[model samples]
Target: MIRTLIFLASLFFINICSAEESKPVTLNVIKTSITVDGKKSEVYDIVQDNGQEGYEGVKGQNFDVLLKNKTNVPVAIHWHGLILPNNQDGVAYITQLPIPPGKSQHYFFPLVQSGTYWMHSHYKLFEQQLMSAPLIINNPNDLYPNYKSITVMLQDFSFTSPDKIFANLKKSSKEKMASMHMDHDMNMSEPDLNDVDYDAFLANRHTLSKPEIIQVSARQKIRLRVINASAATNFWVNTGKLEGALIAVDGNNIKPIKNHKFQVAIAQRLDILLSIPNKKGTYPILAQVEGTKKQTGILLVTPDTKIVLPSKLATSDAPALNDDQERQIHPLNSVVTKPVTKTLHYTLEGNMSDYVWTINKEIWPHVTPLKISKGDQVEMVYTNNSGMSHPMHLHGHVFQVTRIDGKPITNGPLHDTILVMPHSSKTIVFNADNPGIWPMHCHVLYHMEAGMMTTTNYTNYPAPSFYTKMISPQK
Candidate 1:
């Protein structure tokens, strides 16, 4: 019996190693450029060639981002929708060592989540400018409706350099973007409000001299995966001609909402399903941001007809967040407190003048410490006392948005990142199933680096392996 036990243990170890080795892997760091309106531009990229060596490989593959820097400028990448090591969570100076400019960095993980996930430079708000793509983790067990999948990565652009914008934001944090009097105690006059952003917007890296248009035939159900890849801008994604069922958000499935137009905030996503009717000629699909006249990507569906290039859609005056659309419901106490498991509340506090953003008024490298037992149900409240919007994200875990200012969001989907608007409060709950000193902070990469960040530690909560131990709940 002793000999048999030892043999079984050896076999198990060997199997685990081989399985990991068999997971196709490739990594290359290089410079790639895109010609924006006939002008050439270059950006860094960490590419992964999923070594399937066939058309199957083109289906999809997971990749890790390594910050290859020698100047120590702090390079990092966010996995977005991936489960990986705590150190490789990809927030520079937090998860692991930042990739200085002259040094080489690498992120190693698998892409198997399917649906719609993306990767981007997590260094400052530079993500607004570089290394964003449709990271599809093909579902081998796909049991849903079969359709041709099209991935769209939408972006806001600029003729102006990003460096200048960063400088201005650093210089002026209180550059107001329109404020109203929600209070009337006597000081209820029109508050300071100024709507302003630094750049133009694009869909799939192009603007509308000639925008990206999708092709379709009559009677076809197309899967439209849309990603908002901007640094700091919100958009109104609409179909000038085609209407769609809003199906998914941020890689998690949701109850579909039907609307001609809806808000798509920064770092947000939407997957729409549209069944094209058999109509002759072509129809244009348009997606435009509310504030900027610049927009990109319009789908063109034709029924046995030649494609006619669309004339530019007329521009509209920039619009502010309407009260009806920006309705922020508060938590309603429907959330029963999970029995003394674990909880952390960090008042998200920050300033923009010096470009320092923080959680509970403390920046990273020195963040609020949250020590949780493995498998503990964890609840966190992000009270944004600051004036700017922050997209809060927790590494290595997916949580439900349980409450907004104590109001319950009973049917919220599980997510890795939740955007908390300025001056609003949000509460999220998830099992601290993953064990590590994982970084939890604003998904706004720059904001996290500036301040708005925290940590959650799970010490030996008890699972068989490290990966399973961190992610899997132990009942």
Candidate 2:
């Protein structure tokens, strides 16, 4: 009887633990107001019950994303870098339907990978209205008791509504196209930059006039997870005088590159570790816009240190982001490579005069799908024939940069988003182990809205039950 009781008690304890693990963390979607340059602007925000802007959990902690849409409009939030089931990807039309107003949806998936990641709206133009948050997954074993971790989310803000901005872009493109036809001597060597001039640049939703100040101790070690959530701008993260070790990119480990400045393109994340000097001083972590002098950032200061103000614009323009940083990155852990079974070429075609971006010169929703089978190794080559850079993001799988400009690389950094420069070429390889139709598109919000999107379809894979129920079969 004693032995039987002991076994029963153990089973009871296991059941309790499992039940706790299955409980979902609720994230509420609501409209909120933020003051930008003394103007109260209404925006969308995703927050937990405690009113935290984002979610954070340790590795191996399993829970569903119970999204409560409390706003008047529908919403679909994408877990930006997590490799989850295709049905729960939160993409509006691609994987699932949007959660209607006053409705709730549950996203259930196991957290198989851990690193710096984020969540944002995949629906129409909502991301530009600030529907994003940092999703950090910490590995308990990788935790340092003496180190402090800080998250800096970068954004470009405008007072104009997204719909109005998009309409203005279309109007301006037509006029520019007309002017280009009349002037044949226009120089083509200079690449286009800053399509939409933002009213303000922000770090953690605050401009440099009022920056987010972080407290630190003397001689403290710090880990900065900087995420570029900007809609249309690229930035150079300058560490001022302190040198940092760039340890990871896009939530994947990489061979550390020590530098004082690093570039982060749209939808990209950078993890840099630094050591604070043993003196009382303040350090500014600035994010300066590429090809422009506009800047924004936060400050880190030791206790009792005097805070020094920083200017909104730098003295000189920050250079445009190139593949120089991408070329130097190699994965710290070597990924097992499979023999590539499929190879495809795509050209990033677009022009600023007309403002139409496309893959292989074909628009989205009408572009042909790139097909592959389960367990197949795939390689995609992208030649940017446009005058602007494109940060290409693929969902449902992570890939490694295998080549640049026709030169093969060994052990390149694994990323879900890779920036292809103007008039350049980049190649990425991945294993098609996840069976589903996934959207691959430019990370630039306006560029994507202008039709630079496509998909990779799995061969012979049946549509998910939810998807079928949402849409009728074709005749």
Q: Name the candidate that leads on lDDT.
A: 2
Best by TM-score: 2
RMSD of each: 9.1, 3.4
Indicate the worst ten consecutive residues by lDDT in candidate 2. 466-475
Q: What is the C-alpha lDDT of each candidate?
A: 0.60, 0.87
Global lDDT of model 2: 0.87
As a TM-score, model 1 comes out at 0.75
Per residue, candidate 2 scores C-alpha lDDT tens digits across 1-475 of 9999999999999999898777888899889999998999999889999899888877776637799999999899998888888887889878988899999998887777777898999989999999998999888777344468899999999999998899899889888777768888865455458889799999999999889999988888999999999888899999997898898899888888999999999999999998889899989999999999999999999999889979999999999998889889998765447788999788998766667788887776567677899988999999998888999999988899989998998888799899999889999999888888788999999889988888788988776565444433222
TM-scores of all predicted structures: 0.75, 0.93
Report the lDDT tens digits of candidate 1 across residue range 303-402. 5587676544446744533323223222222223365377788788765436677666666655436678876888888887866666676777767777
Off by over 4 Å in 2: 1-20, 143-146, 188-191, 351-353, 464-475
Model 1 segments more than 4 A misplaced: 1-23, 45-75, 98-112, 159-161, 174-196, 281-283, 290-294, 303-340, 352-355, 459-475
